[model samples]
Target chain A: EPEVTQTPSHQVTQMGQEVILRCVPISNHLYFYWYRQILGQKVEFLVSFYNNEISEKSEIFDDQFSVERPDGSNFTLKIRSTKLEDSAMYFCASSGGWSYNSPLHFGNGTRLTVT
Target chain B: TQLLEQSPQFLSIQEGENLTVYCNSSSVFSSLQWYRQEPGEGPVLLVTVVTGGEVKKLKRLTFQFGDARKDSSLHITAAQPGDTGLYLCAGASIQGAQKLVFGQGTRLTINP
Candidate 1:
């Protein structure tokens, strides 16, 4: 089965540095999403992208955060300036449709650690 | 904001025992989904229940959506060690965009 894949399973960066998390969603999937889970906290939605534009975003996805499908296959999330609170497991997901019938498929995730 | 509350944040039982995890919310959802996550991995979809009073079974695991569409439950019969993992419930709101609201999760440990 085709699955979403994320690179750099673990990322460590300085507080003020910029970092980019990379993901390759399922080849045939249409909608892409980014979600993060703080340690011991509920997973929170960051952003959703479809038709090459952002469809929705949460408050946590502020000025520092941005997402782009630089190419047909690679979707990237970049944080302009990292903060301690930004540390978490970031998951990339994709779905063939937005409804329940097309359930989301997720990648293992990228563990971002800011110090 | 929508919130999902999961009961008995942690559960530990011997193999062969049956267990149920509850996910509740004050707000209604258009659809509810159950996911299981192993350590260091993303949540994997187990089942999706869209209609009120809907029930779906995956092997020994049974999932049910509330009649009011505000809660759901996962029941595992004759559980095994492989069932040990973090179970999370997420709901899609009737009015919100395509983002899912997740619960804190229930950690299950099935002992041999």
Candidate 2:
């Protein structure tokens, strides 16, 4: 089955440095999202993108965070300055339709370690 | 606030036994999804329940949505050692982001 794919299975970045996580959603998917899970914690929503604009975002997504669909296939999340709290598994997901019941296909995820 | 809460955070049982995991919330959802994850891997979708009192079964797995649409459950019958994994429940709200809000997760271990 076709699935979302993300780059860099694991990353370790220095505090205050920038990091970019990349994802290539399923080719036909229209909606995209970014979520994070701190170790042993619940998965938290960060942001959602659709039609080339941010459809929704959580408080956890402050000014330091930004998402871009620079091209047709690539969706990227950038953190301006990494922090210890940023150490978590960042998941990228996509869905072909609008219904909330539509299953969102997720990438294996990029594990970020902010030191 | 956490939109979903899963009970019995951890469970261990002998192979061939049955067990159930629950996900509860005060808020109503447009849908509920169940996922399973192994260590260091992203969650893999198991099933999605959309209607109140809906029931779905996949092989030895049974899933149910609560009457009020605010809760859901997953029951596994004759679980085998391969059933061991982290099970997570996520809620998709109708009015909000439509972003899935996940429960803390229930870790299950099935021993032979």
lDDT of each: 0.94, 0.92
Residue B16, candidate 1: alpha-carbon lDDT: 100
Quality of model 2 by C-alpha lDDT: 0.92
Best by lDDT: 1
Ten residues in sequence with the least summed lDDT for candidate 2 chain B: B92-101
lDDT of 1: 0.94
How far is B6's C-alpha from truth in model 2 (Å)?
0.5
**How high is the lDDT of residue B54 in model 1?**
99
If you score just chain A, what TM-score does every candidate get?
0.99, 0.98
- DockQ of all models, two decimals each: 0.68, 0.62
Q: What is the lDDT of residue A34 in candidate 2?
A: 95
The digit string of per-residue lDDT tens for model 1 on B1-112 reads: 8899998799999999999999999999999999999887888999988889999999999999999999999999999999999999999995334599999999999999
Report the Cα lDDT for residue B49, model 2: 88
Best by DockQ: 1
Model 2: CA > 4 A from native: B95-97
Tens digit per residue, CA lDDT, model 2, B1-112? 6489999899999999999999999999888999998886788899988889999998999999999999999999999999999999999887334588899999999999
Best candidate according to TM-score: 1
